[model samples]
Target: MDSSIPSISPWRLSVAPMMDWTDRHCRYFHRLLTQHTLLYTEMVTTGALRHGSVERHLRFNAEEHPVALQLGGSDAADLAFAAKLGEQWGYNEINLNCGCPSDRVQRGAFGACLMNEPPLVADGVKAMVDVVSVPVTVKHRIGIDQIESYDFVRDFVGTVKDAGCSVFIVHARNAWLQGLSPKENREIPPLRYELAYQLKKDFPSLTIAINGGITRNDQIAEHLNEVDGVMIGREAYYNPWLLTTWDAQFFNSAESSITREAVEEAMVTYMERAFKEDGCPWYAIARHMLGLYHGQRGGRLWRQVWSNHKLKPMQPREVMAVARVALAKGAEVPA
Candidate 1:
């Protein structure tokens, strides 16, 4: 919400919506490192929202503003209802997940399978858009299984666009749902960034973001020259400091020169507040911070000290004390 940061253009940098990885605790910690970049929530199933504790699933920190919620489902009514719940919970945007190829997702008749039924996705988008003022976006793969033609993606985008979606986050790889494990699906699929670039060329009016295997800042800058946005996944989570420096390197904001000591102090405060006020378990939030100092001096020692001691049912403040001692030793930490 900084006045100087551009608001109207599509996001130039975004964190991908990875299940079990982009939860509220993870987003809260990432926010400390970057203020301008957009963050996404783990994908939530529409069934979970309709029949489960919707409030608990949607809870997020106030600092994690400009966050988007990704929903997984194919039914228009369920998706629309879920989008309404997301709006009421104060999300900046609602994203439909059409790229996941897991078997569990396929059984629900959603995810990447929806790519084969573009009209159904369009109907779902239209229904969600009608009820929420926030933007309804879509994240999808370039192609599913062996359908490698550019025309396959182009037609999918074309159909969905007619339903009033202005933003499309395209994972540059084709998902081989039949043979690949979800983990292998992310790696084994060959990336076709050219298809995403072509999408930008064809639909100049729509926001086209390219995602898949992007990690380095230089690569992100190069991708930005051709696409509307760049979304980073596993790399962002494993080495989060990459995002902490984004506001300065990409957005040209003043560098956050805050040191490891300062970040630790901030986390201590956050941990206390979350445990006392939000009723979050100490370990639930602590798990996300383990990678915070991933490759820094003494980081592994610091992580080991916490990992070895903190889970023994100690207080959150006690864990911070152990981490501070390990960090003081200044040893090299393996990432």
Candidate 2:
């Protein structure tokens, strides 16, 4: 697990597929920071793909290569059809969501609820694997509600692996099904990383990637020693600068030459192109990069300038000038 040598596994590190957060614009911005870390789209429901606009759900910048599409559904036929659509749209992998505990997903009879129905999860995984050439994976919690016994999850993995799913992303917390908002579900449950390590121990042949309560680079390295990879969620989004060092730190690549300013300029160019090509507004993309200077001296003022709706009429380049001015002004203030 020493990171001095580059990892051979594609799932060695990843950004979690958070709903409404890891959209195409966000993925495009993230791609600027770390090229090797696998990215994923928000959980696109099977019903959305079947009845909604395919382009709106599947379109992504070519730069977001190595990205995966995460699907939320329990039906075998729907999953297979959705997986085919994702593959056809140039996604590198197809992931099934069995980890989300939102009531919306519960109403659809999927997500964390599917853990109690392992055969259904297995059927969906097999159905997708049968149709897609790309790897089919699942993201799930260690246990649901009061089901803390390790056997519950171990058997779930055993059944799904038999259906040709070789990778599992384990969120090492129980998805408390009742009386908790999704945000609370992420925080209220006690993180049990050891359970994820045990999963790796039991299913040595399958790639097991752990998620939950992992933020620092040291924590990521420690988990990699026990599991194949780590999937970062909120931390990765709010403090994306953490990704700038990942290639050299985890992938063993040369340090990234990009500076915060250079990344900002690159995003500006991307914004202009997006607007001309698809009538997409620049703010849609700029919002994702507000954390580009996170933890730096001028981050707040810089973010304030970018988030200001009054600047909507200005072109992206002009807004960049204004933001840089604010950033410099903020830097003059003492800590």
Candidate 3:
């Protein structure tokens, strides 16, 4: 990890850009846990920006500074136009999504399908770089389908690097787009982290961040010793409490652990502000926080109580009251 890489920032920990799961609300919650971590928006298609509401797709809390917006598309012009929009809207970075393997993404002619066409990806990155002053990065898999060669990824990186992309986030697993569901695609694809480490060795100038199935703090620490950064996905979402320790453990920042009560209280304030200013429903934001108490004493009961009562036609603060009671009782919560 060269300190001189123009796009590489001081933050070495990042949240992966999950499609439906890493939305603005989720990013807000994750930001509450760690101050120095880089957060990412969910994958927003180029079509969404061109044909849909740019404001709706790109809106995020200012607290999520150094946030990267991941764009999903194959066309260079469309991607460039969308990247410009993201820059104008105040995103710190614009990341091209080249790793997703869902059938819908493939049908749209992007995602892992672009992995087989590095030239097109280069062109897309070049277009984005030409338009936006912000750094344009790429997230991709080692390979796609049955093509598991190391040269495949090396060439992919080489091609994109030639187009001025210095940052690469490798998921460390190939995408079996044909037979596997997206959930299965995440698990079934065997991780080849050694290949990612080799990539760092091969392109020492490029800032490489490895992602996929990374859960524990020790694993994050170990990978950081090799790669420039580490991106955590589902584990960060399902077991968010793990992030409470990130500032101290990863960033070497001051310890910022808050009790579950404080977290819920913060969420209560957030919900009130959202409802008053943005017309955000309680459930819309609370859905992401259901896992906040995960692995703690009385977690399940808190979830059950909130799940049953929050959906009713009531104020958001009222639902917080329910969660407060559940937490006080010390009900069993799953890890």
| Best candidate according to TM-score | 2
Give me candidate 3's TM-score against the actual structure: 0.95
Q: Which is the winner by lDDT between candidate 1 and candidate 2?
A: 2
Task: Give one digit per residue, the lDDT tens place, for model 2 in 230-269.
Answer: 9999999999989998999988789998999999999999
Q: Count clashing residue pairs per candidate.
A: 0, 0, 2
Q: How many residue-pair clashes does candidate 2 contain?
A: 0
- Return the TM-score for candidate 1, rounded to 2 decimals: 0.94
lDDT value, candidate 1, whole model: 0.89
Candidate 1, position 198, lDDT: 98
Error of 3 at 68 (Å): 0.5
Residue-level lDDT of model 3, residues 1-335, one tens digit each, is: 56685453443789899877898888888888888889999999999999999899998899888799999999999999999999999999999999999999999999988999999999999999999998999999999998889999999999999999999999999998899999999999899999899999999999999999899999999998899999999889889888889889877679985876787778878988998988887777887888988977888778876677535697777777877777768753433
Count: clashes, candidate 1: 0
Q: Which lDDT tens digits does candidate 1 get at residues 206-303?
A: 99998999989999989989988999999988888888788888887898887766766777788788878867776777777787788778888788
In candidate 1, stretches whose alpha carbon ends up further than 4 angstroms from where it belongs are 1-10, 309-311, 330-335
Q: How many backbone clashes does candidate 3 have?
A: 2
| lDDT, candidates in the order shown | 0.89, 0.94, 0.89
Quote the lDDT for 94 in model 3.
Answer: 97
Worst 10 residues of 1 by lDDT: 326-335
